[model samples]
Target: AQTVTQSQPEMSVQEAETVTLSCTYDTSESDYYLFWYKQPPSRQMILVIRQEAYKQQNATENRFSVNFQKAAKSFSLKISDSQLGDAAMYFCAYTDSGGYQKVTFGIGTKLQVIP
Candidate 1:
């Protein structure tokens, strides 16, 4: 069984600034994938970044990066140069490797970008 937890229910950041959203997960599986997804007002789940349990290096996509600590079971997202478009409901998700795995998602943290 796997469970994702986002400690902060809400967060705020200034435009062009940076914000880091914390996420932690517990899983019995040795091989799994961790992900950060953004859902805006339109309700579309967009993949921000992904990290494999076996990888030693963290994953990053442009201004979005992840601090993946397998030992601590923590995967936090860092958004650099935050913009208005970055304001959304961010969800931390997890899925085990291989066939037809079910993705477990956190309750989510709402990010507000202050102008």
Candidate 2:
């Protein structure tokens, strides 16, 4: 079993700037996967980034990167060059590769982009 927490309920960033969304999680499992998902008003969970617990290097996708502190049980999302389309609800999630693979999600953080 695991639990995820997003400290920020809502945040706003200026266009072309960067915003960091914080998240922390707790789990007893050693091997697992961490993820940041973005859900627009359309209500679809889109994967923004992912990290493998066994990997030492942080996961990155273009302007999106994850700062994963495995020992501290923290995973934060960094979105660079913020765009209007980036405004949405972001959720931190966890799922083990083995076992039942149940997904545990955070309450989510709403990011607003200022024009």
Candidate 3:
């Protein structure tokens, strides 16, 4: 059984600054996908960014980007130009591109954007 680990219990980023959230996973499968999901206190899980295992390029969405290291199985999320609205609990998720897929999530990192 594989699992995701988040070393940081909480993180704070000043408005207009940038912050990087660390995420690492353990897995034996070759083909899979990594995702960064943001869950606000009053909102549902939202897909922030995703990366394909085979893709060489790191996935990015607007101010959100991923530092995906396939060899080390590390998928970190970098939020640029942080804002108060960006404050949320970020979760790293994983799912294989095969039958009977199961989604695994990390504990989560609580992000605070201080104005």
Q: Clashing residue pairs, candidate 2?
A: none
lDDT of 1 by residue, 36-100 (tens): 99999999899889999999899989999999999899999999999999999999999999769
Each candidate: what lDDT? 0.95, 0.96, 0.94
| Model 3 worst lDDT run, 10 consecutive residues | 94-103
Top candidate, metric lDDT: 2
Query: Candidate 3: lDDT of 36?
Result: 93
lDDT of 3 by residue, 1-112 (tens): 7799999999999999999999999999999999999999887999899999999899989999999999999999999999999999999999989868688999999999
What is the per-residue lDDT of model 2 for residues 1-115, given as tens digits with 9 covering 90 to 100? Answer: 6999999999999999999999999999999999999999889999999999999999999999999999999999999999999999999999998979788999999999999
- Measured against the true structure, the TM-scores of the candidates, in listed sequence, are 0.97, 0.97, 0.97
The alpha-carbon lDDT assigned to residue 39 of candidate 2 equals: 99
Give the local distance difference test score of model 2: 0.96
